[model samples]
Target: MSASQAPSQPVPPSWKDLGKAASDILGKDYPIHGSTLEVKTHTPSGVTFRVFGLHDNKSSAITGDLEASWFDRKKGISLTQAWSTANVLRNQIELQNHLAKGLKFELISTLVPEKQAKNALLATTYKAPGLHIRNFVDVFKGPLLTSDAVVGRDGLLLGAETAYDAREKKVARYNLALGFYAPDYAVALHALGNLTTYSASYYHRVNADVEASARATYDSKASSNVNLEVGTKTYLDNAAFVKAKVNNSGILALGYAQALRPGVKATFGLALDTLKLSSGSADASAHKIGASLTFEA
Candidate 1:
């Protein structure tokens, strides 16, 4: 075959990310009931630092993270520490390395709140043309294990995932999914929660500046439990965008994000209970408002 006629390479996403397209459109960037500020700084030496602060009517907290990378970002170490005004502290460390062309490994350990026995995890991932696999195991305690695999060809995908509890000597959960990905649109279906819950999602790029998505879920165990959500994202210009979504329970959410400068951005969000609004019983406390500021350099 001529060079121009060679088949394009296949790159399949992981099973856990089967519905990420729709989820990203329909569920992401919609804050709920709080305010957050984040700042990040990156240095030429492959080191980065981040700080986060959150506040609400009743509580406030701060968190910090640091990361260092080497080998062209193929190897890295990161630590996250968080503190709350209530005198709670949490800390975690992660180490990552690329072992081979398509294989990578990670170790995660929680250092604070030492009473937890299963505070460490081992994980690995492998990816190649048309295939992806991921596995995770507990470093202590029951050694719980989980694995996921996905295969794709011609834009069609099939995937499965399972979790086993070694201490319980049983299978904890299993899930299956099917997906079709195209340049302009994507669809996904999933059987989750041991096959008791089913969900479907669709995402479409309406135009250069507009995207839309929808998702629905049904629970076989509870016939009355059904959920549906639809959302849209529209880019106003190069530096600003807006998103809106509504769910089956009559909750409406709106978010607006804009870039303030080269390394700064801000987002504002609001959520309202339409049902309560229509009934004339909505109060300030019945609605949620949030804002976020992010800085990166």
Candidate 2:
């Protein structure tokens, strides 16, 4: 039977099946299409491509985007490009390239307003083989929308990342991240001129089918409130998945994802505002529902 004729919302699948592959390439920032739907394709030549059709609430006029990504395994590099007519073709073009191994570099360019665009480059050096410690240098040019525009030697961002793995302990793992966006180490030490952000996360694997994590974020520029989040992911039977999370603001969210058919998948998400619910306001905006479908070729 065709996917459209199949049940749109079925009973929750068992939490033990995990056999689906994701096609959206821009990480978690990609849009989720509604009834209008989205489609993706992967080729034997290591190319991943996807198209999205965004429709209005009434399913009227449609607008959307096309994205394609490919990797050159031998060269250890990958490239991705996305374009959409929704932004006048000028502000819709984005290109990104990344190198996977030692002396890694990532460059991203995106069109912006004001007849300008921004380009940023990030370079990383691994401290040692099989070690998690690494150093990063970031530089930006063009418009300031994508950067802090600090320039010169002072504008550069110096960062490092390290992690602790505890899989052998059958317990949990911890991580720490640090970043200094100052021109000099002295400025970073002063902690007054250059901006900085720090984050940490703890992750635990409950079993082959479930995992849980908690994360915290601290921004030197905004020290009043540190952001925190706790979340869990579960793999369901019949190729289904579910994720749920709660943030510091008392916002709770749940999402269900499933592969309805071969090369086809769908996701539904709902979020609730605990504060609003506690206030006894019957506003429907306090609760939200979203769903998207995708077909892979």
Each model's Cα RMSD: 3.2, 16.2
For candidate 2, lDDT tens digit of each residue in 1-297?
896785433221111110001101101212232344788889999988888877654455678888888877776667878777655222122222233333444555566544555444443432222232222222342221111111112222233222222333231222222222221111121121122655544445567887666656678776867788777778898688788878888877777888988888887877777878755565665666667788988
Candidate 1 per-residue lDDT over residues 35-126, each given as its tens digit: 77887877776656666667763454443343333323545555555554433454555555544667777666654444433367788888
What is each predicted model's overall lDDT from 0 to 1?
A: 0.81, 0.50
Which candidate tops TM-score?
Answer: 1
Extract clashing residue pairs from model 2: 14-236, 14-237, 15-236, 17-236, 154-183
Residue 227 CA error for candidate 1 (Å)? 0.9
After TM-score superposition, the amount by which residue 61's alpha carbon in candidate 2 deviates from its true location, in angstroms, is 10
Q: Candidate 1's error at 281, in angstroms?
A: 2.3
True lDDT of residue 89, candidate 1 = 53
True-structure lDDT of candidate 1: 0.81
Over all chains combined, what TM-score does candidate 2 have?
0.55
Tell me the spans in candidate 2 whose CA falls farther than 4 Å from its real position. Answer: 1-37, 44-47, 53-63, 70-79, 86-108, 111-128, 131-198, 218-226, 278-280
Superposition error at 52 for model 2 (Å): 2.8
